[model samples]
Target: MVKNAYVHIPFCKSKCKYCSFVSYPQLELTKQYLEALQEEIKYFYKNEPLKTLYIGGGTPSVLEVSELADIIENFRFDKAAEITVELNPETLTKDYFKGLKSIGVNRISLGCQTFDDEILKSIGRRHNSEQVKNSVELAFSAGFENINLDFIYGLPSQTIEGFAEDLKTAAYLDVKHISLYGLKIEDGCFFYKNPPEKLPDSDTQADMYLKAIEILTGKGFEHYEVSNFAKPGFESRHNLNYWDNNSYYGFGIAAHGYVDGVRYSNYQDFDTYFKFPHVHFLTHRVTLKEQLEEEIFLGFRECKGINVQKINEKFSIDFEKKYSQILAKYTASNHIQKTPQGYKLSDEGILVSNVILADFL
Candidate 1:
């Protein structure tokens, strides 16, 4: 059964330069959007008592507390379920957080990006460094214990020292989790049309990633996933659902979900979504070969790597014999290390992970 659900809120105050996610600045349409969203959820949701529910979007914080609570009331959750909301630092207040807690929000993922004020402005982020600090304080004061700060490395004009300082500042805040990402100027973003100056090179970005691992690990955070670190018992259970290749339900325009071996995505345009709120724009039934490939690709993303016995039993194949050549190649180069359970990427291996994982595909 699908035990996780994700709801997308598409309203944002403004678009960020480096963000290509499907979010709109038309706050005027929020009421209509929420109405349509409720309709979609009513038609599709089976009320399975979700284990995790993530409310993400262009800016979910832009909605009123009553509106957000209305959305949450539609679902049934397990007693220990994790409910996370993504918020921007600028839009948060102590009362806002308290209201969120009252409605059962247990985790907050703030889009901190960086503590460098100039860099934040360059990236078209609305919140400043001071706001982020204040927001964290407010969240804590509001009784939130599970908080995550997101940071981006390799930003334009961001030096290694500057990035290190950003991570250190986040760690010092005593948040429970941190997520690090390398900047990517993808199409549909302002940076794609007008590239920023002094962007760090690929090699430099790799260095920043390694440095983050060293610093965060030293600060008592576990590198549980490729891009996420957390204090013990504070890992993101919602995201862990995704990395585990489990099935989930996705509601709202531009959201994607995988369920019962079929992956589906909703329409990206508001008009299309409103007209056919219950219809999926695209759906693909994953084949056995593709599932095996995904099992390997997604499993390797975790620090524990793939469980050989589990894979063998799940796929009814001899794990090592099937990919002996690829295994031997990387193991010889020390890129992949042999673990008691299976194999995992070494520090060097993670740097060229794309190249290695592609070979498996």
Candidate 2:
């Protein structure tokens, strides 16, 4: 029943200042890590022709093309499946892109956080702006028409004008998708210990977001999700599987997966992961009430909000009566609107989406 899969590669040449994900800079662990990852997949993968497969990482691109191929060969994919790999621009080579295409990788997500070299250094990224440009050109030449560029706003020394320029540059690259995120200093990150100076305030960050929505939508990208924009059919299918609450397999250290109403995450420590990669460090059986709450919170993240009729039918509850107060307050305040499909977040609502979405929970 699982149709989507995610493989985490924790290896990186160097870690970023704000990255809190479980990633290691040790290259010596590459061989053993891949072997353990394959074993984990072998244990859980159902051998179905998958709908989507995403290889995300500290740096999946750092591995040799042959090593990447060996891992992919174990999985069976649909003929037209969306296979995506997260690539660090500096690690990409023409031959690597070619090898990926040969192995049926149809999508490429390049981490081009910003086009400013000074900001790049400030954040500890290894690649320069030129490397990002070359990486996109190489991906296109390798026959990957579905490409996504990830950019961040509200970084140290970032300005509204600078972020707008970055978006303009991204649009010029002919990419099919863009993921724009605001920087947050989470615990365990270098930024948490040493906070960056001149970071954007909440108001400035909101302005930056609104500006991006104007620019990207003007360039024909659909604002499908809170942080993602895409061309009509280029929305990330793998991610949509998550928003839709579908079951999938997640493999590797610190990777999380939801299956049969239970959510589980693998161990975070490398030694413990090698000992038992399939054993979950945390597991929670979601209750029906929690599922209903999640369906609303996650669904609202997309432009297409929760379907009232569907919720009523599926949960056998009066959708309107249950949330009558919430509906009345938000709609009256112009934060939500009724549509032919269902109730959706207003444009203004999307600006404060996190705050409003919490009310649903």
TM-scores, each model vs. reference: 0.99, 0.98
Report how far residue 115 has shifted in candidate 2, in Å: 0.2
What is the lDDT of every predicted structure here? 0.94, 0.90
What is the C-alpha lDDT profile of model 1 across 42-99, one tens digit per residue?
Answer: 9989889999999999889999989999999999999999999999989788999999
Root-mean-square deviation per candidate:
0.8, 1.0
lDDT of 2 by residue, 176-232 (tens): 999998888899888999999989997898899999999999999999988999999
> How displaced is residue 217 in candidate 2, in Å?
0.3
Error of 1 at 35 (Å): 1.0
Clashing pairs in 1: none
Worst 10 residues of 2 by lDDT: 352-361
**RMSD (Cα, Å) of model 2:** 1.0
TM-score of 1: 0.99
lDDT measured at residue 183 in model 1 versus the true structure, 0 to 100: 95
